[model samples]
Target: MTAASSEAVAGAVSPLGRAGRGPHFRRREKAWGYAFVAPALLLFAVMGVYTIAYGFTLSFARWNGFSPRWIWVGLENYIDLLGGSPVYGPPVRAAALNTLWVMIAVPLLTVAVSFPLAVILNSVTRLRTVLRSVYFIPYVTNGIAIYFAWQYIYEPNGAINGVLGALGLGSLQQPQGFLGNPATALPALIVVMVWTAVPVAMLLYLAGLQAIDPALLEAAKIDGAGWWRTNRSVVWPLLTGTTAIVVLLNLRDALQGFQVFLIATNGGPGDATNVLGLETYRLAFLSELAPTLGLASALGWMLFLVALVIALVNQRMLRRLR
Candidate 1:
């Protein structure tokens, strides 16, 4: 046989088979696969790559995002953000603190609230799919619609206030928006965030629960363990890795919670709810606060770093569980 025929024979050992067709057909298959994937890769690079490069470039300059050009000033944005410039100092510090709070509280709250619901959902018999869909509806709803509904519900003379008034608890009036109260605003957004996120976590946990062998639960029962004891001793121990994954995913989701807060409170009633996401947004786009593109890029990269670290730690813990 010719050199080409011999090469075709070797390549045809693949599952696709047949030396006669191997070289041309295999290359054709690969070409088609690449063609099919090209659009997605192109879209990903266009949407993600440009922004990342631009943001990084901006972080090293004073480009308020509007002006035609930027003047490079290396690390000035970082310095200004970290309290070097008195103008940008205080808000940056406060925004960092707020970001930290949301990061901690929102994920923890979602895990705590959703895990039990997941357990219950897994246990359901009748109307299981219907019930799961009901719980998941809020997650799929338009966020804008939810924000408006919440605005009405939290209004002084709205449902919440009306209920409080009828119960002789006085009206739940704050005069200013719920976003107005420094003490309550951040925590309030945390609640909305956790609530919206719980359904997804619940679904994930339920999938994990189903993968767990029923025989394990049965064995625990035969050992004279009650329901709670079986869950604690048998169910939960096996669920550690799942829980860790859930936490990691939830943390990633919570980290990007700017839009939820923006829609609900617009990061306002005076910056009470202004986390790093909102702060970066305002710096990058809002107002004429001397667009510190470099600082904004730094903020973007900081978010990326925080997310990366948490994800890495999560992977480590998951491996240890195995």
Candidate 2:
């Protein structure tokens, strides 16, 4: 080939040369990327991968937290939990159901309450920042503090009952106390869960609302669409991503949330408020209860599996919606 033709052929074969980099530079870039990610990978290996593996292994063995001897039970604990062993099986099933109830109720309630508030906040031109801050205070506040406050409010002679009594609706007052009655305890706890969850959901929705094109809403208005029609037709469709996020977060929280129940009800009034998370804690740590670390680990795995399934389902539903 001629010199000109040789040069053109070499250029055609070597795109990286034209870009001022080659295989060596690319290798170095990759090395730097790995170097940057090394710490995070190490942390995940130690904290996530190793722990998960160990926990799963532990679930098949009997061990108190400090015991060096781990007796291999080989599905005995699983049988006790699932194979109709009356002692452990009933509480486990009940707690699982309660957790499911909370997971369903809290997220739906949070979204239903937060969405309209977010819409209003998005439309406001005055004191919007202040109102948002006020709403978000509960999210940032200490959870235990909120639990105690709500506990007082649910007391028989507390502010809620006081107000009802003064309104001459004395019969409406919960003399047994909201948390003291089995019929009301779980629902009351759900109310508190919804209350704490709404602020975060509201913030997420506000962001989603702001990201929407204002011109679309204006066009809808020009087409003689009212508030409900505009939101139902335009806003709701656009906020699907935000809704998915909100639902996942709320579901995870409700499934794993134990602290609120620990402080507020302690799964009291005849296991009325019992849930898997709290039950796990009880089995693992509470001295008054049986220290069944293996059982607790099993429960933890069960919870993890349930959460994983729900997340996958949520993703699939979101994909279908899109």
Candidate 3:
């Protein structure tokens, strides 16, 4: 009935105290935790794990997608693509090469453009929200619509050419069409890819910039560091984490780039813009080509492996940066 006795009773009844006393309380908590997570676990098993397993199985078998029958081809599909078969090897190599090119170009260009824009926007005091929204418009806009708009812009007599002509640089015009020329097609697509990708990276960089301590910048300035020098010395080092995230996301997106190429070039001009994702689509769906679902699945798995490796490497770099 005294305060100490009451406190002792309360402590004995408390779950945390009980857990400290014996293992039963902890076991019950673990059971409840699993019960709470069961639905999500089930959903992941069905949607993620099962699908991955099924795809892996399908990769070794030829299926028309409609027929119940799947011809067990084992590693023939992989061999055809990897062993440089006369039919499928060239396109796969070309597509893989292009995907690698994009994986290199898009991320670097996106970061280069976005970081400066983010720095400028972060320094602005007027209409910052409006400016950010304007920059993010392309990311939220309809992809097909943007591709169509960009197609027109890259046309022979389109806005870009018109601007060039008006600038008295009509000689620089690509009358054959930017998308039609093999030399310019991938670069043009890279430009559009960079445009759509920049806003996301810019937002990330802006967040990183805002998270930086004001004292650091002040200290740098007090030490006679100007705008550029302060950023180089203080701000850049602090942003390594954000930069890693931006690079990883951009790299993954570039490696799997499909919709833009699909809508814009369809990997044309003699496969100049073909990439792994588009190649998978062509193999799986195009009626003119042999419907090699197994081959397509092989390419998909290869892409998945490459992405996984790159992600792991980036994660290591991120840790080192930290």
**TM-score of every prediction relative to native:** 0.84, 0.85, 0.87
Off by over 4 Å in 1: 1-45, 66-68, 171-177
lDDT of each: 0.80, 0.90, 0.90
Candidate 3, superposed: residue stretches over 4 Å from native: 1-43
Tell me the spans in candidate 2 whose CA falls farther than 4 Å from its real position.
Answer: 1-44, 287-291
lDDT of 3 by residue, 66-103 (tens): 78789998888888888558889988888888988998
lDDT by residue (180-273, candidate 2, tens digit) is: 9899999999999999999999999999999998999999999999999999999998998899999999999999989989999889988999
Q: How many residue pairs clash in each candidate?
A: 6, 0, 0
Q: Tens-digit lDDT track for model 1 on 256-288?
A: 558877787877777888888887777777747
Worst 10 residues of 3 by lDDT: 15-24
lDDT of 1: 0.80
Name the candidate that leads on lDDT: 2
Against the true structure, candidate 3 has what lDDT? 0.90
